[model samples]
Target: MKQFPTHIVAVDGIVENEKNEILLVKHRDKEIWTIPGGQVEIGENLTDALIREIKEESGIDVTVNKLVCISSNTGTYEGYNGYGIVPTKVMLGFTCSFIGGELSVSDETSDSRWVSKERVLDYITNPNLIERFKAYLKFDGNIQYIEYITKPSYDLKLKIKI
Candidate 1:
């Protein structure tokens, strides 16, 4: 039996404009549109990391207004070199407000856009993102902390949206 490698800590920035449009980036490497964020750096605050990621990916600066949601994700990716590996990821989803900066596509993204929360489906590569976007819209400042243990592969956990 081949054991899987453990996943790493990752974060995602969900920046919403005044009109409630969430920003997304289509990465050239993956060629898939996703939230504007990456790894949660060691010893850096989550909000800070998210802001930096957003700026680097979409040329947009932001302030994390609140935590929108959290998810535990795990999957397998076949490397281009013909090696297969399990990619386990724990992602923190934030609902951020765009503070400043113009929308310019960066090196990390081949394209970028602001889409309505309800229309995240139109832009996202992952199907479950719509569930998180729904929680971000109805957030009332009282709810915080969504924890899930994703294991056995493909058994994603859903909670913290109360």
Candidate 2:
């Protein structure tokens, strides 16, 4: 049998409140702010993972409405042996509706709050995340596909509404 490359499956949610503010969270170790989400555990479905992640990280309840976009990127990280290993991550971004829950931070997150769309870019500075935010803003009941590379250089290979 031929060995196939392994890819990480991650999920993120773009949650908006009735006030037209977006939910954002800051990780304990990261400076930039991002939407609430994390990796999917083994045997867990995408939507379930997203719900669990959001609840754990931001103490917010959200309902996954629809998939807004999918992004694939390959990045390098330090391995256990101090060697660099490249891994591909396939992330699904979803549009979620805020259900209920008091906004609070978990151990994984330092702060959580709703930010206006105009100020989102001020908090989210990562190029890739900025692109994803743009897709969320331009989502018109259609799914988008974004392909990019983040290790060697941040290059957006393809972005199209499908």
lDDT for model 1 = 0.74
Kindly report which residue stretches of model 2 are placed more than 4 angstroms away from their true locations once superposed: 75-77, 80-86
Clashing pairs in 2: none
**Local distance difference test scores for all models:** 0.74, 0.89
lDDT, candidate 2, at 63: 94
Candidate 2's TM-score: 0.91
The Cα error of candidate 1 at residue 59, in Å, is 0.5
Worst 10 residues of 1 by lDDT: 147-156
For every model shown, the clashing-pair count is 0, 0
Task: Give the residue spans of candidate 1 off by over 4 A.
Answer: 1-7, 74-87, 140-162
How many residue-pair clashes does candidate 2 contain? 0
